[model samples]
Target chain A: MNSFKQKWLICRTVADVTYKEWSAYRTHSMVSIIVGPVYFMVQYFIWTAVYGDHPSLGGIELPQMIRYFGATALIGYLTMDFADWNLSMLVRTGKFLTFHLRPIHHRSFALFQKIGHRSLGFLFEFLPCLLIFIFIFGVDMRPASLPWTILSVLLAFLMNFYVNYTIGLTSFWLVQSGGLRSAFMLVSGIFSGALIPLDFFPHWLQMSQFFLPFQYLAYLPAMVFTGHYSLGGFELSIGQAVGIQAIAVLVTFGFNELVRRLAMKQFTAVGA
Target chain B: MKRYLDVYKQGMYSALQSAAAYRMNFIVSSLITLAGNILFPLVTLLIYRAGTSFPGWSLYEVLLIQSVFTMSNGLSSLIFGGVLWTTMSHVREGSFEVILLKPLNPLFFIVATTFSIDSAGLFLGGVSLFIFSAMHVGAIPVLYWLQFAGMFIAGTAVLAGLTLMMAAISFKWVGNSRISELADSVLHIGKYPLPIFPKAVQAAATMIIPVGMVGFLPASALLGRMHASDYAAILPCFLFLAAGIWIYRHMIRLYEGVGG
Candidate 1:
């Protein structure tokens, strides 16, 4: 119990420090206000143009499409982190050596830092964007089951961090991992249903998604928030989807642990 | 003009040397960029496969627009995209003084120094996609190709103008990297048919911001879809470039170094 308390305190302190550090760059975070709405506006125009008279396309009505995108933007604010970039840069620049002197693991520090950064993002990026989507964009921000949606979104946050962290560990092997990282980001963007609903994809691709963790990053939560859970041709209940998400998170976390151990052995700071 | 051309050639040589030093990274980066560029076309294919498309545009026609958009974007990024990051970093680090002290024009120096070889991926992908879609859409006359050449140059100019403006904003904003995201989101409207947008947005895209010229107008010219009013956008395109240059120069005067 004392160890748990100590760990909690460390996490809180790290998160607070991160929040304070990023608050100075609030303008950077606030850019989402303009970017999110503008992207939504583009979607608005495209969907409006496409759905001229049809009530729905690809099993989603016009209203639900707006909600899906709105949820995506908002959930993205809550969950997104640059952990991969941060870790990779530290490794590449030989800065990861500095963490060796500290008592805490770098992964723990990164996780705590993410908590703090995302805490700030929730306030600065998420809230204002949420209001914009609700009032200006008229997107129904209400969730199917608020508790379940929140739980699902939280799982997604961990899933995203673990996936990106795993990707970042690749820098231990590759001298220049930017290309690989970009490739992963591109694939993740598509497979995560951040680009379009996975339901719109061909059956083969949809079925393939069953084995990937990318869908848990954005699609499942967005679908749950929109009060429907259909992906890759399978309709799942909110409970079942979140349960799968939790399992994916555990599996990814295990994989990340294994990668981290292997990557640490390969670590050699050339300059430092 | 000859001096600037010489400087640009030297800059290209230096950039190519740097890329060669990291040959694997260069190749991988270019391929990733190619894959990233292919994403939108994949999205477009899915949209059309679902039996819905932009009204008045067939799948190949829309793909043509997207491919043109990619090419114009790729060319501009290769030429001017570096200006944004270079200006931002230089200004933030108080190295704008170094740029000012340079013998060549500051803007030219930044643009010349910052040539992006990675965008070759986008350019090549665009060319391939353009060829594939063009083959499907039937042959184009030499006259249309001539018109496309002119309009495509204008399209690239408009993007360069946008790049300069974003770079200029960095002088005041300081490390506002998301500014590019804002620009990209707004510019994304150009990737589609202008007619699909609201009347005001269409007008804004043509007259005020003139993003339409970046893709729609060029592709329309190629596809024989250009209306008479579309030519009006050409003047704004030049004006916008002038405005961007003016803004950049003006912002340079406003820059008070890192401390002040």
Candidate 2:
């Protein structure tokens, strides 16, 4: 085989190994699946209270809002990335040196491994849970623009992965990214609109979402899934969302590649 | 008790040295925590700005609950976090034997030895929020201030107790590491007004989980939103602490060490 095909095969094998590895942790994966519904349950009551005697709040009806949250839950599970954790750990423990000896790029290897891990998790946990939620909420679950939405979600995953990979590379210098990790965990839930709909945010902040990549992680996809964003809704524009997400993937990946090159120059393996 | 205090003082002194050696990491970690805690209140600020208020909850009232939860949870995690994680891991690895070899209570030693300075970022963020929201909450009687302090401490106690209990359960339940995450989800719910939840969830949050007292109930008492019965909410914290202690003791007896 040519070198390119050989590398691709190796990356594919990494994904397979990671999928089987993650599949062993049945109980851990099950927690979020269990927790997502309870979250929706709490959201159900909270929204009911917010919408009492009213048809909608902020232009979203109760059922639609609940469905948005349900979709957000599924999309969240699907797009979540922890490549930074793997990178940080490998750097901290000096295991990253081993990657230098391997022909495949570390970033490519980690990305493929995560793709495998998330695929198994999406299949075993998110798919069934989302279907059940669709039944419970009586949501249509049908996309207004299947092709565009699929493209948007694919870009969403790429953007999310590169963002994490960049953060993970920081460990090459920072040595301990645990604090950064916790901080990211806390901030992303809100910024990504997984905690609350970005539509409910103030106008300027919602506008800022057009500039920030975080919204592509959950908000944009969920909105696309809910068909809330038509070709153009209130001037924010679906075309703009797609444009920004595509640009974000390119810009973030460039940043990650630059960081990797710089960090690799100074990298010294200090431990076994 | 004095001996335990002395041990804790020594442990804290050592922790400070460790902090000094990794000063940059320590500072960055705290800043991260500070940033995280501050971002949630901003989310609340925007939600209310969108003209969608949680019925019966003014924006400031919700901020007050978020503030209280941050302070109580931060304080508990800062103080008991060492005990919480170490105890669970030690039990799992059968390293409880090493803890027993020390001439002190294993729980107290664990709690004392592990002082998380990083939580100070969260605690400070909470204080900032509490002070900022207090300006809008209006003047209150001195008694209400006292009531607020009492309830806050009690709420922290309940949080600490719940954490310890979950750690203890991890010993017996194997693969129950996620129980602590479950507890966290409960506290996450407490970020909003408890009254907004269904009666069943509210009841569970009050009696079974006692998470309501972790923040919402205490803030409500300060706001005078609680009923006569709600004043007794602090009563559950005592029971939770007692149960936690009892369970930890029972689990220690059952610790057979890590099996081959």
Candidate 3:
């Protein structure tokens, strides 16, 4: 009970810092806000062309496709943690010490801060555009069904926090994570359903997704909203997401310790 | 002209050296380009299977147009890769001044400074995929390859023009490339045959943004689907050459020396 309040205060502190970091641009924050939907819109535009030739595509008609992708656009953006900087960046620049100066645990701080950016960013940037798309397209966003949607979204939040922080820890060893980040984008583009649904992939790719942790990050939650999977499947996806997230958090913690001792022990502060 | 060659040679040498230093990054950057081209199309193809025969072409023809676009894009990235990100940095930091201070053409120097040799990977990916798609369409006559080579050069010019035009806009408050991002989304259209779109959309894509000129028109010429827009080639072809030169001058005019 005593430690719980301490953690809560740290989470609140990190959230404030993240909001300030992202709010640096008042109007231009729209760039990042539109990024998700615009990305999805691009996917929708071409897929619409292709589907124009067919009456139904994998059980998704034109309206459904548009509606589904629109939802995907909003959800994907909200789940993203752009603050997932390289641990190596912090290490190389000696910025991690700043985090150490505070009493907060680095991983929890990173997660909550990223989540704060997501909340503020989604509210300001994506919500208006998303609402417009919803009305313009007459999207059937069943309000009654939102309870499940919220739960799925929570799982997605947790999973992304794990994935971002975990992958960010890899920067400790790599020194500069720009290359790693780009590679991660390529992998995520396929597995995260940013490019296309994992269902569309060949049997082997779909099978491989079970072993790799990409599907739970963005794809599964979006699918739940689209109503592609049954309640049971959605539960399974959430379960898998929770499981993978736990593993990722453990790995990130380990990597954090490894660098804290082996690599970072050699560092002298430039500021000093 | 002699001075320009010397500049070009020095730029190429420095680029090569920098690229050699970051071998792992170069390889990964290449794979990123390849995966970007491949993944979405493969996914779209799944939906295409459920859709109509895709306006009159097969999966292979659609793949052909995309490969051409990727090749052109890859070529540009190879030539001006480093400077792609330079636009953001320059705009944000007001480094546009140093670009103006150089004795040589500022636009030329700015572009040459960051030659991301990472495009060599893209070039290879493009060629291999082009041939792979071509074989699926069947071995074409030798004249086809010659014309492909020529059109490819045109395609490269068009892509570079589009990107440079976008970059030049960065001269003014980062030029809200919202339009360019929307334009870049045309990669989906590029991956498909043109007729897949509504006639009006096709016409608009041709005239307004001239995206059709990048991959579609030349691709149609290759697949033997020659249409009026294929002749639209002469527009972006000469237009890009002329527009690119003008944009460079415009960027120079916008320069307020931060280089001191």
Give the clashing residue pairs of candidate 3, or none. A53-B52, A54-B52, B82-B116
Give the candidates in order of TM-score, highest first. Answer: 1, 2, 3
Ranking by lDDT: 1, 2, 3
Candidate 3 scores a C-alpha RMSD against the true structure in Å of 3.8
Question: True interface contacts reproduced by each model, as a fraction?
Answer: 0.90, 0.57, 0.43
Tens digits of per-residue lDDT, candidate 2, B1-260, equal: 78887898998898889999989888888888788777868757876776767888899988999999998888988888766677777776767789888888877878889998778888899989888887888887777788888888878888888888877877776645666766676677777888888788888878777888878988887887768777677788778878888888788788787541
- Tens-digit per-residue lDDT, A1-272, candidate 2: 69889878887899899989888875677777667777777777777777777787667788778877887887777777889998999999999989877877888898899788888878877887787687875666666677767877888888889988888889988988877777777777787888777777767767777666778888888777767662113544566667767887888888888998998997997546
Which scores better on DockQ, 1 or 2?
1
lDDT of each: 0.89, 0.79, 0.65
Docking class of 2: medium
lDDT of 1 by residue, A191-239 (tens): 8988788888998888888789889999999999988988767888989
In terms of lDDT, the poorest run of 10 residues in model 3 chain B is B174-183
- Measured over all alpha carbons after superposition, the RMSD of each candidate to the real structure, in angstroms, is 1.5, 2.8, 3.8
| Runs off by more than 4 Å, candidate 2 | A1-8, A135-147, A230-240, A270-272, B172-179, B258-260
Error of 1 at B214 (Å): 1.2
Q: Model 1, residue A251: displacement in angstroms? A: 0.4
lDDT of each residue in B1-260, candidate 3, tens digit only: 88877888888899888777887777777677666666535664665554454656778787778777777777877776555467656766777676666798876786677776777767677677778878898757766666666667776676677777767666664534353563365444555556656677577556655666667766776776665546655566657746866885787587664553
